[model samples]
Target chain A: MSPVLEVRGLTAGYGSLTVLRDVGLTVGEGEIVVVLGANGAGKTTTLRALSGLIPAQGSVVLSGTELLGRKADARARLGLGHAPEGRGTFTDLTVDENLRMGGLRLPRNELPAALDQAYGLFPQLTPLRDRAAGRLSGGEQQMLTVARALMARPRLLLLDEPSMGLAPQITANLFAELRRVNAESGTAMLLVEQNAAAALTIAHHGHVLESGHIVLSGTGSQLAGNPSVRRAYLGV
Target chain B: MALFLQRLIDGIGNGMLYGAVALALVLIYRATGMVNFAQGEMAMFCTFITWKLADHEFGLGLPIVAGIAGGVIFGFLFGAALERVVIRPFESADHLRQMIVTLGLFLAINALAAWIFTADTQRLASPFPSGALRLGGVSVSYHQLGVIAVLLVMALALRELFGRTRLGLAIRGASMNPESSRLLGVDVSRMLMIGWGLSAAIGALAGALVAPAVFVSPGMMQTLLLYGFAAAVLGGFDSAPGALVGGVMVGVVQAMVSGYVPAVGTQLQLATAFALILMVLLVRPQGLFGRVSVERV
Candidate 1:
């Protein structure tokens, strides 16, 4: 499969402190690539840097366009959907409004279809469309976040810790939905997660990030079965 | 009873003017999370622009209505330019810094208007005909009725804009969560600029509406600004509707206090208005219609 996203020599930090150094990765067309890391491992930072949420020194090419130095909104309009950490829902806005915001760049004629597609993917959100996003439960908010990201119909979706604070069963269902989205829509995804076992279950390939560096890389099963990865991440 | 009714009607007319200014304040506050100390001065400047456009002897000899329209358009461009040029640099700055910048603008814009317009109070022709309609021993002047009618229409139009339009949704989303909004392709910066522009446009209209009452001068909006701030606080800083209601309440209380209270009359009107606001705030810290924000850690 051809690469849809490519990054090389990404170095980013918060004012005076460098967190990600020489980090590099790629997502192939319709591929699910997971980056596994622990707390403070710069997993979130990497995704933010890629999405132009922060200043970074790197070469990030989405499809064929260079994304470095562009504003976050500009990058988003170029078909990069980022479901940020903590499910950055506009708490005051209704769920339907939030979905509309996600499709802000879509052609006006395509919006209804996009909304329909989003509601179909997360059927539970349909009933709560008019309710405020902050009023939704954790599982529902996560579903909304993922569903909102998909509203853009992006070529590449950057997901940060989709299982964070979610129940195991909910996480499983979410991963299953993500897998289905990948299979059906052919949208590539680059997911960062601490939940190694669950992320690996659907990821086509994976990388282990340690202190901002990619320390190991392999196919999903290869990393899942690796004794070191299992002990360190899976707590097995 | 007739006297009381007349005072109430007069109070509502003044209150609508206050509400117009307060609405402008609320718009900027919602968009940028900062209370612009310069809001009144900005309106004052736009009022001078209106005067210049309408004044036959000194400037453009356009019809008063056309001049007011020109002022509103100028206000929009001036406000948008200020946001893009002056305020955008301070977008990421802390609240204190932003407040200081607005305070500086308050002084600067006020001085700029004084220099440009010569600080002389100028007469602005009222759009309404000078007449009063009497009903049941109480009379309401056409100017008062016009102010009330115009404000109601403005408020309803604003409500429609915010409640129904895509631009309004983007602005709301941009203000509430800018970072998340950017990820949604909302162009948060542009939304913020538009917010400032819209607020200034409303302020321009407010200035034009009130110019006939207070006359056009640099210091004209000073008292109005204080009352507008009071109205915004009374209504709930986050609510557009609250600002209007708060303005009317403040106006009624001021009128009633000055008219009825023998010892403390018109001179003590501002104090009485604040006293009421303080009481209401003490009871409900969020103001009449503001939602108490609950942040999740």
Candidate 2:
């Protein structure tokens, strides 16, 4: 499969404190690639850097277009969608409004179809379309965030810790939906997660990040079976 | 009873003017999360522009409505340019720094207006027919009725803009959570600039509407600004509708107090308005219509 996203020598930090260093990864067409790490291990940092949320020194090429030094909104207009850590919901906006925001760059005629597609993926959101996103339950907000990100019909979706505060069953359900989305839409994803087992279940390939570096990378099953990844992330 | 009704009508007219300024303040507050101290001065400058355009002898000698339209357009450009050139650098700065910058603008713009306009109080022609409509025992001036009508229309148009448009959604989203908005493809900076532009344009209109009554001068908006702040605080700093309602309430209270209360009279009317605002705020800090914000840790 051709690569949808490619990164090389990615390094980023907040102020003087470096969080991600020399990190490199790629997501192939319709591929789900997971980066698993512990707390403060640069998992979120890597995604933030890629999404242009922070300044980074790297070559991040999305479909041959260099994304480095671009602002977050510009990258988004170029078909990069990010559901940032902590859900990144516009808490004051209604569910439908949030979805519309995701499709801001989409043609006006295409928005309704995109909205319907999102609602179909996360049917629970349909009934709560007028409800404020902040009032939704944790699981529902996560669903809305993911659904909102998908409204852009992005070529590459970057998800940071989608399972952070969700219940295990909800996490499982979300991962399943994510996997279904990948299979059906042919959209590529680069996911960062601490929920190793659930992430690996949907991810085609995985990388283990340790202290800002990609220490190990392999197929999903290989990373799932790796002793250190299982012991460090899966708590097994 | 007739006197009471008359005062009430007069109060509402003045209140609408205050509401217009308060609405401008609320727009900037919602967009930038800061009360623009320079709001009134910016409007004052725009009013001067309108005066220059509409004045028959000393200026452009355009029709009153045309001059106001020119002022509104100028206000939009001026406000957007101010955001891009003066405010953008401090986009990430704390509230204190931003406040200082606006306060600096307040002084600078005031001085600039005084220098350019020669600090003279100029007369702006009223677009309304100078007559009173007699209804029952009370009479309402056409100017007063005109001010109320104009402000209400402007307010409703703003409400429609914010509630129905795609640009409105982006502005609302950008203000509520800029970082998330950027990820969603919102040009947050552009939205903020538009916010400033909208506020200043509204302020220009407010200035023109009130100019006939108060006359155009460097310090004309100073008292109005105080009243506008009271209105905004009363309405809820974050709510657009609240500002209008708050302005009307403040205006009514001021009029009633000055009319009926022996001690308050005309001199203490401003003080009485604040006293009421203080009481309301003490009870509901979020103002009349604002929602209490709660953050999740």
Q: Which stretches of candidate 1 lie over 4 Å from their true place?
A: none
CAPRI-wise, candidate 2 is medium
Candidate 2 chain B lowest-lDDT run of ten? B288-297
How does chain A of candidate 2 score by TM-score against the true chain A?
A: 0.96
User: In candidate 1, what are the lDDT values of residues B5-121, reduced to their tens digit?
Assistant: 999998988998898999999999988888999998999899889889999988797899988998899999889988999888999898789889989999999999989887888
DockQ of each: 0.67, 0.68
- Against the native chain B, what TM-score does each candidate's chain B reach? 0.97, 0.97
Model 2 backbone overlap count: 0
The CAPRI quality class of candidate 1 comes to: medium
